[model samples]
Target: MTSAEPGAEPLALSGVLTAAEADDTARAIAGEQRADGAIPWFAGHHLDPWDHVEAAMALDTAGRHEQAAAAYDWLARHQNPDGSWYAAYAEGDATRPTDLGRESNFCAYPAVGVLHHYLATGDEAFRRRMWPVVHAAVEFTLGLQQEGGQLGWRRDPDGTPVTDALLTGSSSVYQSLRCALALADLAATPQPDWELALGRLGHAVRHHPERFLDKSRYSMDWYYPVLGGVLRGSAARARLAGGWDDFVIPDLGVRCVRTNPWVTGGESAELALALWTMGLERRAVEVLRSIGHLRAEGGLYWTGYVYADEAVWPAELTTWTAGSLLLAVAALTGDTATRAVFGGAGLPRGLEADCCA
Candidate 1:
């Protein structure tokens, strides 16, 4: 499949991606999956639980259902007894826990992928099979939430919780919690406690600036709340616009950080998804077009480009980067499951805090 020309016509809302490109990208991602089912950042690199799930979701988007299930099964097999996976595992080696810490966001993300897979396949058996995994992971994640509604980032190897909340990480967990609730609904189970946790987490994301660590320079912290469904409508639009000049490199893509000249495929693709979520299809198409420079010959994407140096940096083709692009394209093309997950359709709205009560 030939790559879409950058700055071509605005992508069609129903058929945004060419069939060939989607298939190639899916193949690229699949090639990176190990025999044990882990999709690492790249061959020989370490796999983080969060990025592994991201890649699996992309595989599901690309119509590779069985491969996606295998990815989840790897997570299930490796999950610690307390419902967490270590922060990182060595690529091609499931037995090696490269980082022993268990991150809240990473543990929670599998639910999002599991639910997305269920939506794509309508596999009741798969849904039932993954229910316990999702349940335990959500419980493990919520166990780390502080009173201020933001979740603690991770636990040390010795089981001590690190209580600082991260804006980007917590925003991700917020989305996962929503997906977890959706999964529970599908399974005929309800989680009132998680619903409350979702509400408070949203409140903290929207109103409690002090609750999270200050990482304003990073683009993810700026746009993740919107991408993760914590912010919506005009507020999300304003947030995107507020950082446009600082993070976006016109005709290049979104920068990894405000001060960096590096444009990352994953961040650029995520911003496109966020823009699409806000009904800015034209702008979203443009944002996605700008990232075309990152696509490699095999349909996998390079991690990032250093515009100042005029070279691709890191020199690695990451599974999650390609996955992010596929997911964004899926949303742009109006794929039903992609739309449902990102658009929060049929997902429960949590209770609002009653300040007066």
Candidate 2:
């Protein structure tokens, strides 16, 4: 994604897109959005809150702000009084699965996403509308936190919330907290509970490895703290370096699950994002070159290659897959304060300390 012809505006980081490519991508995705704005995946794929948000971010990056906003509006409208979204929603021809109850994390990421949109668009009305929902979601996570300040993973309809904080899940929560506080700040709302909770969660991430339940060897657990700005400098260095061997796959790309026979486009793109965050410019560049592996039939990306690269599995090119690539590219190319944080090299003023705990 760097300049080979020298200069070229760093290629948009979501990889290069012409006005045509951007439009086509947006139109295709926008076509999937239901009248109520629950954007489905591809055509028949079910709507998922996580994937919906991810897709909306991609739409935003693609200059499809209206469509992206519509997607966010859908989330805000459907959020429960408790600040949570349905664990899973019916999508397209798909109905909600009986197996899942409302998930604790289902709402966490989208609230943060709305705030990100607010940052880019400077939409006060949107921010104001998004704040209480963000507060509720953060409040929901608080109820699930153990005395040790770690979060639970899931919630059941009729029972206690699952009490294990996943490493990546918690990392996401850590990110959502900062985003929530930022939304509160933008609206001049003083959320002392958010600040206190963010700090406790930060401390837990800083000190307790045992607090997180994800021991599976995944690239996200390795680089997310740094990628999400929860880890920095020596801590960032130590965390990423510690997980190196488990992720990289020589000339191919980063592997997905260790036991699973997969190496993926999104995972590799995310690594590029994390490396750029941690100031690994050269490594990130190499990754940018390596990412051609996961490119898809329509020039989109199939999630990953399975069976030792024999084929691409679960063959779907997702909006969030594209969204991760876009955000990673924004890190590599943009110069905002967020770029500094996501680059994992720095955090904004006073943000590094006494903030997000």
Candidate 3:
């Protein structure tokens, strides 16, 4: 919580974000929140459920607990009767659903946000209020899980579930399931079914590449398994090293996709968190430092910079990018709640395949 500004100096390996930078970014993100509590990608942009939760988590990191809680309340209010949300909303306007498809990963992310918020504030009432929300969302998400352990990416606008799975999305869902299970444990509600589901999900993520869509060119598909805690130990390290040269640009941050020259703030920050989770703090600090140029004067972050074109391609500031950066910094500074959420501390590991085999 040092009040240092992010200047030219190299960020300290132990504390990559200063209090000023975190506060500024948090305030900037807060500004994007609509009256209804939805945080859009930016003002006038659409809001996706997953990214909305990500930004809310960052608000918690910055000690903006009220705003963070409001964001969750927004989710609670807007949740579909079936425990899902449409893929995207028009600029936080819940009345205008831009995409009717219900994405499993997006639906499940509220659990992560709720757990993080409760951890940060130690508010049992908030946890109690959000419990049913978490339960319903997880149920909806798990309903879409294929027998192979990979989650179906989305349900069609007509409510037909897509059979295809996405590595990155399912990996994210894995983390969400873990968080949901943690919440259940805290509430003294054990979900044996979820623990069983987690095992199959983890087994699929770590062992069944054929079950998911081939998005190996995307950096998320490469790093998400590690970031989501589905991969660990030597396996996680090896997975990261395998993609290091292809996605990581020295001093420029991480590329969004392997073939793209675009280095995005969100992906870079996420990779930093992944590295931190793997106990590679030095590399994590370096990755976080590389994205410093994305920071705007107001502390919001531009979506990406295209090194090949020497331009910011998206020409937009995104709240999720800022959120990711804040979360990464939170992990680096050893913020107990943030660390516990990301590091899987005090969280159930779920059942292993052998347990049910």
Candidate 4:
């Protein structure tokens, strides 16, 4: 599907991207979107709830309002009775789930997307329609929150909880809970319990590394707390500084894993977002620009480049990589709605105390 006519003004990122290029990237993501609204990583790839929502939010940043709404509608239709979605669906087809596990972070992500759509379009009716969906999904996710405030990662197919928590996943959920609370406030249906949950979750993300599994080797684990808005000010700065040398490759973007030579577009874009969250605008722009080599001809991005091998390891382009890049650019360019979501100034910070203590 051709997303927009040729002559539209570009959402240019100064020297990094042009208007036409931005629209092409957004259209590329839209083109990969299935008839039922699910957006896989690529055509014929499995669709996961978390990345699906990310792609939808990117569409919103690009002013693809109708497509974004359709993505959310797809979620509403496919959500399990208990509010979670299967971790992966075959080729965006719900009937052919590739993974039966239900992940807490993945289940919680639609709240971010729904709220982003509402912020971008001022669609009160859409927000209202999605209210219950967000509510139920949050409830299902928080049901797995450990007593220490960190959230259990997922539930197996048998419905058994995987009690161990993941730093990256919990950090993402921190942002999602805040977004859900924001939605709750807007809908005039305040959730006091969510506020309390947010507090505990924040405490875990901010101070309790021992409670989460050790995945510091991955870039997401290193920076998600900041990107998710649970870490800020001096703490966020220190975290980024500590990991910079290990994960970042100066002009080539960020490595997906500390021990690997692969630089992924998604991780690089997200790190840019984390830097932007800490008010490092110039550095964020540089980081975004560093991955320019991954930009595919049609506006999508290759998944990752192996610098050691001097090759793009993943031949396929991914919607989430493009989505992440668009959101980062939108945030950096001062797009009001994107800034409101990622900038964390407008979103409510539920009681911020150590509820677990």
TM-score of each: 0.94, 0.85, 0.95, 0.97
lDDT score for residue 357 of model 4: 65
Instruction: Estimate the overall C-alpha local distance difference test score of candidate 3.
Output: 0.88
Off by over 4 Å in 2: 1-28, 92-100, 307-309, 335-357
Tens digits of lDDT, candidate 1, 1-357: 112223222223333356676677888888888888899898889999899989988887777788888899998888889999899987746689889999999999998899899988889999998999999999999999998888999999999999999999999998899889999988889899999999888889899889899999999999999999989988998999999999999889999999988999999999999998999988888888888888889889999999999999989999999999888988988777778888886777676673211
What is the alpha-carbon RMSD of candidate 2 to the true structure?
4.9
Q: How accurate is candidate 1 locally (lDDT)?
A: 0.87
What value does the lDDT take at residue 307 in candidate 2? 52
**lDDT scores of the candidates, listed in order:** 0.87, 0.66, 0.88, 0.92
Which number leads on TM-score? 4
Order by lDDT, highest first = 4, 3, 1, 2
Q: 1-357 in candidate 4: lDDT tens per residue?
A: 346424323478976678889988999999999888899999989999999999999888887888899899999999999999999999999999999999999999999999999988889899999999999999999999999999999999999999999999999999999899999988898898888889999998888899999999999999999999999999999999999999999889999999999999999999999999899999999999999999989999999999999999889899999999999998988777778888878888987767676
TM-score computed on alpha carbons, candidate 2: 0.85
Top-lDDT structure, candidate number: 4
For each of the candidates, give the backbone clash count.
0, 4, 0, 1
- TM for candidate 4 is 0.97
What is candidate 1's CA lDDT for residue 118?
Answer: 94
Model 3, 1-357: lDDT tens digits are: 222223312212333566666677787888888877889999999999999999999888777788889899999999999999999999988899999999999999888899999988889999999999999999999999998888999999998999899999999998899999999999999999999999999999888899999999999999999999999999999999999999999888999999989999999999999999999989998998888888888989889999998999799999999999988888887777788888986778788664321
Worst 10 residues of 4 by lDDT: 1-10
**Which model, 2 or 4, shows the larger TM-score?**
4
Error of 3 at 327 (Å): 0.2
RMSD of each: 4.2, 4.9, 3.7, 1.5
